[model samples]
Structures are given as C-alpha cells and as structure tokens.
Target: MLSLHANVYAHPEGAATGPRRELRGLPLPTLVGPGGGPPPFLQVLPVTFEQMQAALAELPRCDCEPDGFFLLTGHTPEGVFWRLNGHMQEYQPEDADGPSMHRIELNGECPVASLDAVLRTIGWPKAQLAFELVREGVTLIEADFREYASQPATEGEPRRPDRGASRVPAPCRGRDDAALGTSALEANASYTPWHITFGTYGTRLHGDRRPTVDLEHNEYGTPYLPRNELRRRRAEDTLTGPPVHLSAEQRRLIERLLPEICHRGGWRIHTAAAQSDHVHVICDVRSEVHGEKVRRLIKRWLSEALNEKWPDPNRLRWWAVQGSNKAIKDESYLQNAIAYVEKQRTASR
Candidate 1:
C-alpha cells in the first residue's frame, strides 16, 4: 500500500538517464503493473531522489489526534490486538493477489503508550516507529499500509488527521486536544531534516563555489562560488591569522575529537568530517537547538583542541566568520549530505 495516499511524483528524464534503473549507482524501484511478470526493466524511471523529496515535502500534516486508523507490519501478536482493546484486522499487502507484506489494520481511538506497553508486554521490539511513505501510481509503491495526509477543514469539510503514522496512536476518546501527539504523528509524514554542510574560513570566499551549499543548504550538484570575489572577501574580513588551513593531521585530529565535543554540547554526531579549510558535521539535536549555537560550540571546542595540541602562545581563530545553517526539509537531503561528507574523506585520502 502507498504510505501516503497522494499519487507518487515522478520526473520523467532528469535522474533516469543511466543505462540501468539506477541513479548515481543506486538501484531504483522496479516499475511493474498488475500483470507483474519480470517486474519491468530497471531502465524505466521509478521515483527519482528529487521526486521523493518533493513527495515528502507534500506529506499530510497531523492537525489533531491521529485516531481513526493505523497499520502494523507483521501479524500483530494476538495479545497486542487484545491489549489495544480496539479493532485489529490482519492482512497481507498483495500484487496480482500475491501477498507481499504482513500487516495489521488498527481502528478506533488508541494511545501510543498503549501500543508501546503491549509491544513490550508481548516481547516485541519497542520504539522503531517511523512513518512509512511509498511512491505509487506510475511507480508502484511498496509499504505496509495505505495512508495520506488530510487537507485542512473547510467550512463544511472534515479534517482527517494522519493516523498514528507508525505506532504513535493518540487519544480520541473524549478530547479534541490539538496537541495530542501531533508531533509524533507527523514524525515521518513530513520530516524536517536538520542535516547541513557548511564551509569553513577561506573555503568559500565568493558566491557560486563548487561543493558549497546554497542559501537553502542544498549540497547536491556542483558547488558555485565566484572566483573573482576571493580577494575582496579577504580584504573586508578581519585577519584571523591568515585563514586557518587545517593540515591533514589537524583535520584527522578534529574528526577524532569532534564527537566528544558534540556530546559535551548536548548534540549527537551522525556524520562528520574535517577538511583543509572547512568542516562538515551532521548531528542530532533538539528542534529548538540553534545552528549558530552548535557552530559556536564547535568553534570553541576546536580552537581549544588545536591550542592544546599545537601549543600556540597566541590563541588563533580556526573557523570562518560565516557559514550555512538551514533547516533540511528533504529526507534524501540528509542521505545526500552524508554521502557528500563521506566522499570528501575518501578523496582527501
């Protein structure tokens, strides 16, 4: 079933130029019809990464309680069914009437905690929930259940909330509380990725530099920075010891110590790299956490670490005065950022 009821978005020829159904060497999903023989040639365009991002951006928001219905992967243990004290129907997702996925339909007002308690009580894994969205229609979507984001209520129209995206059920018994697990329900529906790839001092002196993130912080495509403005930027900025250029050794050291620094600052590192004139870090932090604050903490920690290692009498600034910090809205955006950072490490070696 399509995770979101909306039709899958597809860009016919953009990322589908490869000989096989692959973009940048990653295989795309097979586009097949109900007849379902060989599952179509990979050369056919399936959901492109960009299209997937677009689809995610258009996901339904959970305005209120995600109560009416939900689905679970695998036949829920009978105990779980009884525990929910709600309607539970077990079925399999099919193609050509062929069962493809094990799932259970849940109905009625349910609490997320109730599901958690039951899962734990029945020895099921706890807290691995995320909204399952799939691209369907032109591109066959494969997921455990059918779901779609609901539109806002009109004068006489009804507002249908996203149902317990994963196992995050909410109260529908007696309350119309607007805050009832809304965030949790929208977790996978329309995710806000916080991944960013910012440049360090001297790394980006002008606009349109290669490998540079745009104002929106998109890391895909070639970097764009004007070669002409380098001199102008250097003159306008305060000299902080001739633009810190990390040596190979220094970069490696920073990579090694950054995790602990991030931990100290109450951020969890996901992927990180240090380069000659720039650094990249993707860390998990609270939604309220400020990017400037994260950047500041890293700058201080890095300066201290360098000072402790090299033992400079006069403390030196190790980063640029400005950098990119924007909320990542695409799901694939983080994946692309991780790949970009990882590739930087590979090429540097």
Candidate 2:
C-alpha cells in the first residue's frame, strides 16, 4: 500500500537522482530500506510540475464538499516549504500590490470510498487515502505517506457557511481524519548540508577604485580597503598578489571567527575560506536576519581577532563597502552559492 499510486514517478537511480521517470513505460524502482533490506512500507513520488499537475487533475473531488487537495511545489533542500507555514513569508514575492499567491489546504473527513471513487474516475486505479507527509525546503513537496491516513473526526458535523468552517465525513467513512489535523501537511524530508558560504567585497571579487561613499551606494561597492590604503596594498600584492596579503595565521584567525559570528546569531556555519581579496563563507541565517547585521558582526570579530594576533598600522575592513542585502528564495540560487563558495579560488580568478 504505497502513497500516490507508488509508481507515479519512478527514477532509475531512485527518487534522489532519477532523470525523472514517467508512467508512459518505465517501471518504478522498488524502494528498499537500508542495507538492501525489504521494501519500505512507504514509497515516495517526486513529481515534476507537469506530473504534479496531471496528478492534481486525477485527484477526486470532495464528496463532503469544499473541494480540496494537498498541493506541494519546489524541492525540500531549497527552503521552499518554509513559506507554507508562514515562517518565510518575506520570501514570498509581490509585484505592484497584487494579491498574494499561495497554496490552499482544505480538510474534511470524507469517506475513503467516496475519495477512491474520485481516484478511480481520474484513473488512479489503485489510489488510496494514506497519511500525507510533506518535505521541507525552498518549496514544499509531498514525499511519502502511511497506508492508513487519519483525518480529523468532524463526524458528519456540517460546518457553518458563514463561519467558513466545514468538516464533513461522507468521503471516507470509518477512516480517521485525525492525521490531517495539522493546519497543513509538511513533507518528511531533511537535508545534510556540507558547508555554508558568504561573499566578501574586494578587488579580487569586484574590481574598480572609487570613493567610499560612492562605492557603498554602487551595486558592487568599494573594495574592503580604503582607496588610499588599497593603493598601497595593491602595490604590494602586484608582485606578491592581486590584493593585500594576510599571513596563513591571519587568514586562519579570520576564518575561525566567521563560524563564531554565525553561531552567536543562531545560524549554522558550513565552512569559510579566505582569498587574497575576498573570503567565502557558507552559512545559514534566519529570514529576518539582516545581511548588514551579519556582515557587521563578522567584520567586528575579524578585526578584533586580527588586531589581537598582530597590530598593524593599516586597519583592514573585512567586508566591501557595499550591501549584499538579498535573500535567496529559490533552490537553484542557493545551490549556486554553495558551489561558488567551495571553489572560491576559481570563482575569484
């Protein structure tokens, strides 16, 4: 008894890396447990936009009324699911004051028989009401489910139209609706990130010399060193490097302090690597966390740490004088940043 017809989206390498299977011909891979054990009781359907739309069309309409269905989109590793529970509402985009677009969830205790009829009509053929588990990420997606789905026990209680409350039990009688009790069903998935990364300002990352005030307002911003100081540093780095050179110890100190700032702010630091002109950091910050605040914390810590290690006449600013204030709302963007951080050397070159 698999969820979502089990065979809906079969991948050759498994759901995790499959090229995207279709029911047109390919067979769904058997979902095995750890150590090549027996097939797991639950099966996952990693659906694409088109596939999801097709499946949505096949879902049976509610016999209990207030027609509803669980809708999921985006990947679990991308933080898309966070928007569903309203935690990442800031990520939701707005254009010219238009109505906000969001998925809707409707819960009513409909008899399983009636629900099955809808599935049958839609050609599910073996669809069943199972526990719906959602996965988290940039966007939410339904990953798997239990054979026995429990719905809230509205028990034939007709909801008042004026009150906008309805819980009918005609769709799946005897089947418990208690499981759907939550405001919305979240997916059952998690991510194991290797590291976090952040971008720094400097000539290596961004080239050009301008006044500090003008640079701060520019998209790229001024280099980490002031024009007067950078001119001297650039001269040193000219033969020795492209920017001022920090000893391995200085670099190490700065790197170590990055994780400290992220941790103090209740964020996770994946990794930090310093280049001649810029440093790359991978970390997870909250939606409400200000980018400037994060930069300031890291800069303050790094400056203090470096000063303690070695007092220099030329004070160094850790970040470029520009603002990189923007949140990544999509998985692709987040992933790109991760890769860029890992290969900061190549990216800077």
- The top-ranked prediction according to lDDT is 1
Candidate 2, residues 75-178, lDDT tens digits: the string is 23443221010000001223323212122122222334433433333234443222212210011112322222232222332322231222211222111223
Give the alpha carbon lDDT tens digit for every residue of 84-112 in model 1: 11111111222323211112222222234
Candidate RMSDs in Å, in order, are 23.0, 23.0
Clashes of 2: 36
Which consecutive 10 residues in model 2 have the weakest lDDT in total?
82-91
Error of 1 at 140 (Å): 71
- Candidate 1, residue 168: how far the Cα is off, in Å: 38
TM, every model: 0.39, 0.32
**What's the lDDT for all of these models?**
0.41, 0.35
